[model samples]
Target: METLANLESFVRSADHGSFSEAARRLALTPAAVSRNVAMLERNLGVRLFHRSTRKLTLTEAGEAFRNAISGSLSDIQAAIAGAANGGGEPTGVLKVSLAPTFGTMHILPLLPAFIARYRGVRPEWHFENRQVDIIAEGYDAAIGGGFDLSPGVVARTLAPAHIIAVSSPAYLAGRKLPAGPADLAELDGIVMRSLQSGRIRHWTMRDAAGEQIPAPLREVFVFNDPAAMRRSALLGLGVAMLAVPDVIDDLESGALIRVAPRWYADAGAISIYFASRTLLPGKTRAFIDYIVDAFKQRRLAERFAGSLG
Candidate 1:
């Protein structure tokens, strides 16, 4: 009943804290994880975790087992990688999560080649607006706006994201359109809900001297989803602050106009986020390299027109 495969499942379950999540990560069924953990417990004469419908926790014995095994396992992973790099093939599933906007606009369109080039790579993609806990959710990697990884997990930048203050031309009608950054105080517009966490994601602008300035908020419509905010903005609902990629087409088609020249800010540079360097498959590493090179090749900065640079 006890085998290395079962032990591997136990380790994965302990790491992820949920049998279902571990199963997802391993491409196994939840029942498989449960059975493996049960076999491990029977062999060790102890329970490793407290299981419930909604949560999982390790027991005292389970904690000790992890302390003993986690390192050796990590080493084993390194050995495997070294061998694979030497001559072996890398075959595995790669799971990734991404924000809806970036996933749809940038990532999804570019994934086909990754699949085609790598014959052994299988990918499962998760796209959502809400933030995801990568470790707990059993993801191999992620691409999104915010970066708050758990201590053990790590991340890298895929590209620099730029944001712009935008408004419908119809909303600017008869409103004494703001002339510069300081003039924003008197104007009202739609606001992204995510930007208004306790305080508004105030508009950022630049003066003639190129000094960055903040524009205060007076908003009536607010939504967290950029796509939602974009729709409202297009309907002449109100001026809205949003990421440049979200409104690139609108700006080109004369749907949404820049509110002020100085309001664009390079939202922190975001890149491919993933777990540690251990046990990485060629698919993930190769795909990441492809995307990073592609983004750099396209010159995201030049495309976004940062501060008229």
Candidate 2:
């Protein structure tokens, strides 16, 4: 029989592709995790990982074994947590992944109230720009847009990720304001380059009247991150197509103004993602409920809609 620690070490190591990260999550040393995995491999009589200096990859047996035990391990952990927390109270570290600017501006404000309400739940948040593997990486939840719904994961949409062209008032001072999406081509563009593919993103703007037009702003500046693009737009660099949620505050504060106000692009929905398990952890449930309630109270979906522009 395999010990729970060995199984946990193996699964986490596989999820993160490194023992150091697994050790950090487990609060064990890398050497300890490595030894636990070694012990498990010896008992199983098969090597699970193809260990290399740069990467740790799962063998065929390792992948199959991990798939077999990962869900069971999660369930066992959740059961243990439930029993320890008196079966109801939301307790333990609620690890979540979030986008940097959006999380800081929008979600972080709700923390005080959340902590006050659920005193036992501690938030462990990672502000990142990329989509994370919720189950594999052991994240309680993730908040972002355009995530592929992998098996055993589910998403609840919080807001429309409507993209709209924006520019600083200073940048538009001497330029002819765009009358429509087509006119946007005359202005200098602060465009986004996809970090994943290294390709420039092009958008088609839609009006409230259901009219669509190609948005081809002359590319003057390019960035990989929306926050960086927002900063550049603020510096009077050029017009940028940014997610409404990311620039709502700036728009409200008059730091950034919508270009071709009648038109916008539909990016997708900003969603909260979590593992789809039969029994969710109390902390995870509480966090999800709190965030959903917050979005409702704030009417973020309506506010984030670009059609309103």
Best by TM-score: 2
Off by over 4 Å in 2: 16-25, 28-62
lDDT top scorer: 2
The per-candidate count of clashes, in order, stands at 8, 0
Q: What's the C-alpha lDDT at position 9 in model 2?
A: 96
Tell me each candidate's TM-score: 0.76, 0.85
Residue 221 displacement in candidate 1 (angstroms): 1.5
RMSD after Cα superposition, model 2: 3.0
Q: 126, model 2: CA deviation in Å?
A: 2.4
RMSD values, in order shown: 4.2, 3.0
Q: Give the TM-score of candidate 2.
A: 0.85
Stretches of candidate 1 above 4 Å error? Answer: 1-3, 16-56, 59-61, 64-92, 195-213, 305-309
Tens digits of per-residue lDDT for model 1, 1-309: 457668778888887788887888788999998998998898888999998878899999899998787656654665666577664444577788888876787778877877777767677888877667765566767887667776556777655566777888898888887776667767766776554364546557554366777766577777667788889889988777677767877888989888875556667766678766566656667767777877788675456554552
